[model samples]
Target: MTDLECRLLVIGGGPGGYVCASRAARMGVDTILVEAGRLGGTCLNIGCIPSKALIHVAALFDTARRQAAGGMQGISVAEPVLDFAAAQEDCAEKVATLRAGVGGLMERSGVKVVQGHAWFRDGKSVEVESETGTLLVRAENVVIATGARPVELPGLPFGGKVLDSAGALALTELPERLAVVGAGYIGLELGTAFARLGSAVTIIEAAARILPQYDDSLTRPVRRRLGDFGIALELNSNVTDWQAREGRLTFQSDGAEQVLETDAVLVTVGRLPNLDGLGVGELALRMTDGFIEIDEHCRTSMRGVYAIGDVTPGEMLAHRAMAQGEIVADIVAGHANGWDRTCVPAVCFTDPEIAVVGLLPGEPSEETVVSQFAFRANGRAVTLGDTEGFVRILARKRDHVILGIQAVGPGVSELVSGFALAIEAGLRVEDIAATIHAHPTLSEALLEAALMQASMANHG
Candidate 1:
């Protein structure tokens, strides 16, 4: 057994863990990061990065297919053939390149990367079972950045034809008829990609509508686009059973039983915090809703121990984890910091992307004025030939201080940062209205929405 010591030890080499370790180490704190898998964790290895790459490929193929069917804007092309294996290989290459970049960043930042599975020996000590031998690490401060895993359905377990988001990304061959058993972002994203790639995709959602977290208005365009892509949606449905031998999935919907003959089923209902086999039980750490509870500074109940990322509360997003990691790193490096950010933006890369930040419509507010600017009216969107959605801004009725901003349109994901910045800067509707946004750009829609809220819309 080899024993080591550090001022800071991060238990998972994900976005949160690696960020915390590297940032702290650069600040002159001795830090060590341990992981059982790739350095980038789920987001890089199997989740966000690979998924987006697949989505991009799907979009390209879809555009080509459309052009072949009938030329768009005088652009014509032959019916595109999809090489699934090559697409997968490209995604793999992207992940590997990013993974290597992350490793380089850690090395340059002076973070020691230990490849192993680590478990708590005590509050300040951890024992890692590495391939070479048993290694023990003692640290003054520890951050639990162990991320979450995909939640599986009760009856239809993951394996064989049943796949989680990770398993779906690693598929050797795309299923001809795919049944995705969730309507959340993950399900919709993958389902849309497969459909674009020529798979007959059916999305089954237990909720009443797709993207149940968002309001009907924001998701309506997405729903319409799904139909345009020839994908089926089964809302308000519950999967009862799956027969592997018969390739049949049984579900109950609206007091009726239905069956779907699918080549494979991808279940992505949700994700649970990954706390299994970590021996956290021995530490007796406090947990809330099955996740490690932490304060604004990401400090857990245990002294010198902290938690971040999906293992803790808040949205399970890579950017959120990175922000929290920055705060923890600053605090550990003898500076003072806490979570005081105004909002965390969320983006869904659907047919028409959805991006939102700050408060929604129904959230507790004192007399809010909601205003919207349709992309159809925006010159840039009209020129782009995809004007199917709108941007809505919610603000305080009296002061017009922007409370929330929600958008559903083409490439709205790129506009989210500016929306977040506006809220963080406490910009009122008047402020956005007065700002000069570039003409013939999607960002002009934000200004126009604010102008509408301010009752001075120029191009609404």
Candidate 2:
């Protein structure tokens, strides 16, 4: 066994681990990051990046198809056929480029990247096993950012015809008909992407509606868009069993049992923290609700041990992990950094994107005033020909301090930054209303909503 020493050792080169290692190394701390897979982790390799790349390609192909069918004004042509293999190749190329970039970033930041599986030897020591040999890394601080994995449902484990998000994304051959079992963001996003590429898609949701986390108003337009896309949605549905021999699924919906034949079934209920092969149980780290218990500083119960990302109980988002990683690194580097944020924004890239920050829409309060501005009234949305949602703002009725911002429509994902900034900086509704917004833009809709809430603009 080869023994090594470092100031910091980050296990799992995911967004959190990589960021923390880079920051710590740049701060003059000798850092080493270990990972069994590619450097970019789930978000960059398979989960978010590749999926969005395919989604964007689907959108482009869909636009061409619709234009060929004369769905748009002053546009007509022949049907555009989808090149599935080519699309797959393109996504792979993009993912590889990004993976290399992540490696380059680590190299420039003076962080050593170890291509191996990492597990705990002790509280502050880690053992890395690669193809060459065993590496024992002892550090002043060890951070676990192993992230999470797909959660499997009983009786329908992932394999064969059943697939998780990663499996679904890597599918080279598009199914003639794909049955997606879940209506959350992952299900809808991938399911919709498949449907756009000419697959007969059916979504089965246990809840009454798709995106049950979001209110009805925010999801209604998405529901309609799904219908327009010819994708079937079975609400309050449950998949009882799968008949692999015949490729049929036995499910119950609306109090009736039915059978749906499909080439593949994608189950995306949720994800669980990646703690299994890391010998975390031996470390005696506390767990909460199936995740690692972490404090504001991402500190575990043990001193000098930090955990972040999906392994922690909180928003299992990349940005959240990244921020937490940065904070942990700063604090370890003798800099003042703590977890402090009013709210974080969430975006769903369905047919029409959804963005939410701060207070939830229609959150109950006697002194709160709520107002909305429809995208139908926005010139940019009209020009884009995809006006199906609105931006709503919640603020104090007395002082007009902005509390929450929610929007669903085309390009609303791009507007999340403005909402995030406004809420994070403690900007008021009046402050937004007083600011001059560029005319004929979707951003103006935000200004209009704020102005309407402040009673400064006459809204119809």
Candidate 3:
């Protein structure tokens, strides 16, 4: 058995783990990062990046289809045909490129990359089973960034035509009819992509509305887009069972069990921490709901051990995990930084991409003024011929402090930085309204929303 020693040993080479390992190595800490699977983990290899690529392709195809339908001048083209094999190939290539980039980063940072499954021998020691042989690593600090996996439906067996998000992304054949379970961001984003790609998409949600976590006003634009796609939405519905026959999937819904012949069924319910075979119970670490409990500094209950990313708690966004990774690196380097931020932005790549920052879950205060500026009013949106949503701002009535900024429109994802900055800096509504946004642009809606809150409209 080979033996190795390091100052920091990171398990899982996902977003959080890789970032933490690289940062630690740069900070002069001897770091070793071990991964049982691909270096980029789920987000890069399967989840965020690949999904965004598919969304972009679908967006382009949809735009072309719209141009053909509208008979726009100088926009003549044959009906858009989706090459599912090409799309899957493109996703695979992007994942491979990103995986190589991550490997290069590890090498450049002087972080040793170990390919194996690591099991804890103690708080400061790990035993790994590698292809070459067994190896033991002794370290002063350990970071568990094992990340998460998709939650499987209990009764509905996932095989054949029934698939999870990862499997759904890998399909080379576009199903004529697609049934998606769960209406969360994952389901909506992919379902919208598939719908744009000419699949008859139906979303079944146990909740009363899609994106139940988001405010109704914020989700209104998405609902409208869903209608535009002719995508069936069965809200307040549950999937009792699913069976596959002759390359078709049949599912039962609530109340009257109507059957729809589906070429594929995509499941996007949720994700749970990936703690299988990690032997966390053997250590003195505490767990909350199957996730390792960690403090703001990312320290686990056991001394010299820490946890971050989806394996910990809070939001399961990739950026959140990256932020935690940075904080953990800082803490390991004896810095005083912690995971404390006023706002964390989230984006959904639906038809009218939804971006939100610093939004409180409940109703706005009575004194808190809220305002909206529709994309229909924006000259850029008019020129693009894709006016579908609006930008909304919420602020305190007393001090005019910005409470939250939310937008549902084309290219809203690119505008999220400004929203996050406004909330993070505690900027007043007037400050945003006073800023000179360029004329005839999508960003003008942001300025308009802010201006509307101040009871003044430069351009209504």
Clashing pairs in 2: none
lDDT by residue for model 2 (1-460), tens? 9998998889988898999999998999899999989998999997999999999998998888889886667888788988898999999999999999999999999998888988887888888998889999999999999999998988789998899999989998889989999999999999999999999999999999898888999899999999988999999999998988788998999889999999999999989999888988768788888898988888999989999999998877898899999998998899998888888789999989999898875564647888889998888998988789999998877777788899999999999989999998889998998889887788988999988877755444
Among these predicted structures, which one has the highest TM-score? Answer: 1
Superposed model 1: Cα runs more than 4 Å off: none
> Which ten contiguous residues of candidate 1 have the minimum total lDDT?
451-460
Give the true-structure RMSD of model 3: 1.8
lDDT tens digits by residue: candidate 3, 1-460: 9999998999999999999999989998899999999998899988999999999888888878877786564586777777889988988898899899999999999999999999988888899999999999999999999999988887666777788888888888888989999999999999999999899999988888899988898898899999898899988777766656654434455566666667888989999999998888779988889989988798989999999999987889888888999998888877788867888899998878999998653666457878888999899999988888989888888998998888998999999999999998999988998899998889999999888877687778
What value does the lDDT take at residue 74 in candidate 1?
Answer: 83
After TM-score superposition, the amount by which residue 225's alpha carbon in candidate 2 deviates from its true location, in angstroms, is 0.3
Off by over 4 Å in 2: 362-366, 456-459
Model-by-model lDDT, in order?
A: 0.93, 0.90, 0.88
Arrange candidates by lDDT, highest first: which order? 1, 2, 3
